[model samples]
Target: MTKERIEKILKAGANVVLTTKGIDDMALKYFVEAGAIAVRRVRKEDMRHIAKATGATMVSTFADMEGEETYDSSFLGH
Candidate 1:
């Protein structure tokens, strides 16, 4: 929920962020500021379809999410 983290995520050149929950105001602002689209509340089936179509990696964990001291670049969907 940190801007710096969100900024880092967008900086990885993601086309969009597909989530299982609706996006909130803070996240929307961050995505807009970083020039990325945020697609929220996507169904798992659709997420799979999009992943197959785009060849983007899906991250199941924030253990490696952006901007944490333990952040790992591989968590990014690019």
Candidate 2:
């Protein structure tokens, strides 16, 4: 897997990221290093509820998270 894509996935500001398919060992290590929690095998329906409850927008790709380096605050639910 490309580190660039992995970096993008890792950089999402959410406190926790839920994925239908589990992440790999490398990703797990990166997540630990970044202090982010990644929950795998999340039910699609549950993911919907989580986004709604946490006021987070569900994004399919990390490319949309722009202008993060200029700001320190995490818009993602904490």
In order, the Cα lDDT scores of the candidates are 0.70, 0.64
Worst 10 residues of 1 by lDDT: 64-73
* Cα lDDT of model 2 by residue, 1-78, tens digit: 345655665555544767787788887777778787878889989988887888766656444356343212243554
Clashes of 1: 0
Top model number, TM-score = 1
Question: Which consecutive 10 residues in model 2 have the weakest lDDT in total?
Answer: 67-76
Query: How much is the lDDT of residue 63 in candidate 2?
Result: 43
Clashing pairs in 1: none
Which regions of candidate 1 deviate over 4 angstroms? 65-78
Candidate 1 lDDT by residue in tens digits, 1-78: 567657666666664788777778898888887778888889988988887787666766555345444334554544
